[model samples]
Target: MRTDRIFGLAVVLGALAYIASAFQLQTSFLSDPVGSRTFPIIVGSVAAVCGLVMVVSPDPEPDWPHGRTWARLGIAVLVLVGYAYALRPWGFVLPTALAAGIISYQINPRPMAAALTGIGLSVGLYLLFKYALGLGLMALPRDFPG
Candidate 1:
């Protein structure tokens, strides 16, 4: 009943369920060659492999966090959850910037540096996803940017 063993069990079970769900996914008329299930299958396989590896050779003595670290962790989790909820409405760039800046500030306590880092990451990733990947992510709404 070790920590790693529990983690491995969870990983394996989650991956198995995910892969099974992938099989139920309907194929699109104009989808990629491998179809939609490819990513899920690949992800599940990787998770299964990692779970097995962990079960066989778990971390000897994991460093558990304490004190302020727990508070920071809680804040970080809340920030991420907020980011997820706001992603579609606020759009990727703003949420990314906010989350990144908050995390940066949480780590080092520099507001200006955090804001700049957030802006840079948001703008950079927006262009990358839009241009390089040809993904259609929503930018700021027409009225809001101006």
Candidate 2:
């Protein structure tokens, strides 16, 4: 299948997932008038529309996937899973930084650039989740106050 076709199918699947999530979500008394399902429903509707558009649009040049692409994708997934498992024990910084670094390396060839990008992303995420959102993400060993 062509890349565009695959992308279109992915979009459709995402929309279906969103729609299903919206339906399956439990409502609470504290829920606003829009409800927890509203956003998902809207997102699903938009994704469905975009998928439909893609499906009907003119096909672009087909670019077949190489073996290395699959390997890279597998590595990325593995990194993500490792990060999830490592988050609690290793805390947010190290695992997140490693994951970001791996992703950066996958996208870029330069080692220094990849490392910097990863560190930058990790710090930015820390600031966003910790300070901006006030989330209690596990801190690094050095940052932990016992």
The number of the candidate with the highest TM-score is 1
Q: 1-146, model 1: which lDDT tens digit per residue? A: 37798798889888899999998999979998889999999999899889988788787657779889999889999999999898888888889999999999889888899999999999999999999999999878545756
Worst 10 residues of 1 by lDDT: 137-146
How close is each model in CA RMSD to the real structure?
7.5, 7.1
Q: Which stretches in model 2 have alpha-carbon errors above 4 Å?
A: 1-63, 141-146
lDDT of 2 by residue, 38-141 (tens): 88898899998898778768387577568998898899999999888888888888888889999989887688998998899889999999999999987686
Off by over 4 Å in 1: 1-62, 142-145
For residue 23, give model 1's deviation from the true position in Å: 24
Question: What C-alpha lDDT values do all the predictions have?
Answer: 0.89, 0.85
Count: clashes, candidate 1: 0
